[model samples]
Target: MAKAFASAGDMTEKTISFTEVGEGLYAFTAEGDPNSGVIIGDDSVMIVEAQATPRLANKVIDCVRSVTDKPISHVVLTHYHAVRVLGASAFGADQIIMSDKARSMVAERGQEDWDSEFDRFPRLFEGHESIPGLTWPTTTFSGRMSVFLGQRRVDLMQLGRAHTAGDIVIHVPDQNVMFTGDIVEYHSACYCGDGHFGDWGKTLDAIKAYDLDAIAPGRGDALIGREMVNAAIENTRDFVASTYAPAAKVAARGGTLKEAWDAVRAACDPKFADYAIYEHCLPFNVARAFDEAQGIDTPRIWTAERDKAMWAALQG
Candidate 1:
C-alpha cells in the first residue's frame, strides 16, 4: 500500500512536557511536535512560538498558569510557518515580535502556508477552527532587538536564513539559554520545504558563536548543558548535511529528482528513519536540496497544490 501523504495519517497524540531548563526558562515540548519556549522575566512572560491554534495554545497557557500568575506580555515568532505562529491570539500579548523579513513572508505566503500545513499535519491542528487567522507581528526588527523584562535581558536576533528566510533565535544572555526556532531541531527531521540548505549551514555556524548553557529547540528534548547544546547543534548540522549532500551530489551529476531523492533516502534513512517527521519531510527536503545543488539560491514558495504534487511524485 502507498504511504499516506505528509503527516495526514499521523493521528497519535503525544505526551507534553514542561521542562525548566534555566532559572525561569522553560521548554514546552510535545513529544516530537513543534516546541515552544517560555521566558519568565521579573514582571511578565515572553513566549517563543505559538501553537497551531488558539485552543491548542490554551494548553500551553494552562502550563504557564500552573507555574506563575504573571500575564504573558509578549509572543515572539521565530519564523512565518503557520504551525508556529497562528496561535498568537490566545496569548493576548502586548507585543507580537518578529523579524521584518518574517513579517514580509507572512504577507506573501501566509494563506498558502496555512492551507498547506493544515493538510499536511492534521494532529497538530487539533483546534484548527479556533485559529483567528494569520498571526501578524506587532513589532518587527531588521537585525537585533533587545527586550528588558526588568533585570532579565532577552535578545532576538536574525542570524541568517535557514529553515526559513527569516529565522530568528531568542537569547537569554544572563541565563545562557537560547530558544532556537526550527533553525535547530534535536532528534527531529528538519523540514526543508522552504529552507536554504547552503545558508542553513552557515547559520548553524553563527549560532555556535554564542556561549550557551541550554537550548529550547523547535522539537525533541531540551538541551540542558553546554555539552548537550553542542551535541544538539552538531546533530542538527549532520542531519542537514546528510539530507542535502547526497541529493546535491546527484543533482550535480545532472541526475533526475527521483534519483536525487533516492540517494538522499538511502543516505539518511539509516540514521534518521526513527526521527519525528522524517518521512513527512524527506520529499520536501530532497526537492529543496536538489534545487540548491542546481544553484537555486531562493526557495520556492510552497502551495497546497504543489505539496500534493510533490508528495505524489516522490511516493510514486
Candidate 2:
C-alpha cells in the first residue's frame, strides 16, 4: 500500500512519477495523490491538467522533456479546482483552455479554494510558493472543442457535471484513450465537496458511450485495458452512489444534517475505508451529499472556518 501520511514538509521537495498509458500519452501520478495527464501528438503536446505549483509542474515537464521536445502548446484544465489549475503558469503553454463555466468558477471562488485546498492537503501543494497565483485559461469553450495536431485528433468534451460543474474529458479517438479529470478517480478518494451526484451519474453514463481502450484517471494508477477502464468508471459510479443514497434516504425520513452525515459515514466507511485520503474526504463528501439530499443545488462555500466547524460537529 502507498504511504498515506506523508508529512506536509515532505511535499515541498517531492517529485512525480510518469506512467505511459498509451503510445505518447503519460499519466503523472504521485502515489495516490492527484495526477496530471500528458498527450503528445506529431507536432505539439497537450497537457490535460496542471499540478498544484510551478515547482511541481516542472517535474512533469522534465518527464515530457525526457521523451519528446515538442512544445506544450495547450494546457487543458479539466475543471476549476485549485490543485489542478494553479500550476498552469509554469507550463508557459501558448494557450490555457477550459470550459466557460470553469473560468467563471475561477473568477468567483478560485482564491478561496486555493486557500482551502492548501490548508487541507499541504503535502500535495509541496512547493506552494512557486504558484504565480490563480491560473486562468486563455481560451474558453462552451460545449466541445476539437483539435488536430498533424493527424492525431484530440476532442475536449464536457460530458456532464461530475466532480465539479465544469468537468471535462479529453478523448483521443484513434488511441481510444481518455483522460478523465476529477470526474473519475481510482483507488484514491473522491472529493465531492463541489460535486453533483445526480448529474455526476449521468456524466458517467455519457463516458461509457465512448469507445475507450484505456483511461488515465484524476487519481491512482492509469487503467491499461478496456476492462480495467470500465471497472474504474464503475467503481467511481458506485462510490458516488454509496455516498449519496444513505444521506438521501435519511433526509427523506426527516433526518438532521448530523443524522444524514452519520448515515453516509456508516454506509461508505466499510466499502471505501481503505482508499487513500478517505479520512480527509469523508466529512466533506458527506456534507455535500447531505445538502444535495435536501435539494440544495449549488454547494455552499467551504471556507477554512466552515471546514473546521463541520469537522468538529460531524467527526466523533
Candidate 3:
C-alpha cells in the first residue's frame, strides 16, 4: 500500500516529557515530534523553538510554570520553519530572535512553508486559528550574537548550515549545554526538505568541537552525557550521509527522481527506518540530495502546490 502524504496520517497525540538536562535548563520533548528547550536565567527565561501552534506553546509555558515563576523574555527561533516559528506569539516574549538569513527566509517563503506544512501535518496545527500571522523576528544577527538573561549568557551562533540556511545553535557557556535545533537529532529524522546536505557534516563537526556536556536536541530525547551526545551527533551525521550518498550516485548517472528515491530508500531504510518522520522526510531528502549533486547551490522554495506535485510524482 502507498504511504500517506507526508505526516498527514500521523494524528496520534505524543506524550510530553519535560526533562532537566542542566541546572535550570529543561527539554520539552514529545515522543518523536519537534522538541523545544527551556533556559532558566537568573531573572527571566528564554525559549528555544516554539511549538507549531499557540496551544502547543502553552504546553511549554505550563512546563515552565511548574519549574519557575520567571517571565519568558525571549523566544529564539533556530530557523524560519513554520512549525517552529508560527507559535512565537503564544510565548508573549519581549524579544523574538533569528539569524539574518532566517529572517530573509521568512520574507521569501514563510507563507509558502506555512501553507505547505499545514496541509502536510494537520496534527501539529491543533490551534492553527490562534496563530496571528507569520512570525517575524524582532532582532536578527549575522554569524553570532549573545543574549544575557541576567548574569547567565546564552550564545546563539550560526555554526554553518545544516537543517536550513539560517540554522543556529544555542550555547549556555557556563552549563556547557547546547540546544541544537534540528541540526542534531537523536532517534529522529532530520527534515532535509530545505536542508544543506553538503554542509551538514561540517556543521556537525563544529558542534562536536564544543564537546558539550548536554544537548537538548531538536527531537527525540534530551542527551545528557558526553557519550550519548557524541553518539547522537555521529548518528545524525550517518543519517545525512546515508541519505545523500545513494541519491548522489543515482543523480551522477542521470537517473530519474524515482530512481534516486528508490536508491535512497535502499540505502537509508535499513538504518533509519524506525526513526520518527523517516517516511515524511525521505522523499524531500532524496530530492534535495539529487539536486545538490546536480549543482543546485540553493534550495528550491517549497509551496503547497509543489508539495502535492512532488509527492504525486515520487510516491505514485
Q: Could you say which candidate leads in lDDT?
A: 3
Off by over 4 Å in 1: none
TM-score of 3: 0.98
After the best TM-score superposition of candidate 2, give how far the Cα of residue 110 lies from its true spot, in angstroms.
0.7
lDDT of each: 0.91, 0.85, 0.94
The C-alpha stretches of model 2 lying farther than 4 A from their native spots are: 1-15
lDDT of 2 by residue, 127-175 (tens): 7877878898899998999978778999999999999898889999888
Angstrom error at residue 231, model 2: 0.7
Sort order, lDDT high to low? 3, 1, 2
Pairs clashing in candidate 3? none
After TM-score superposition, the amount by which residue 115's alpha carbon in candidate 1 deviates from its true location, in angstroms, is: 0.5
Better of 1 and 3 by TM-score: 3
Q: How many backbone clashes does candidate 1 have?
A: 0
What C-alpha RMSD separates each model from the true structure?
1.2, 3.3, 1.1
lDDT measured at residue 206 in model 2 versus the true structure, 0 to 100: 90
Q: Over the stretch 115-153, how does candidate 1's per-residue lDDT look in tens digits? A: 989888888898787887789999999889999888999
Give the poorly placed runs of model 3, Cα more than 4 Å off: 1-3
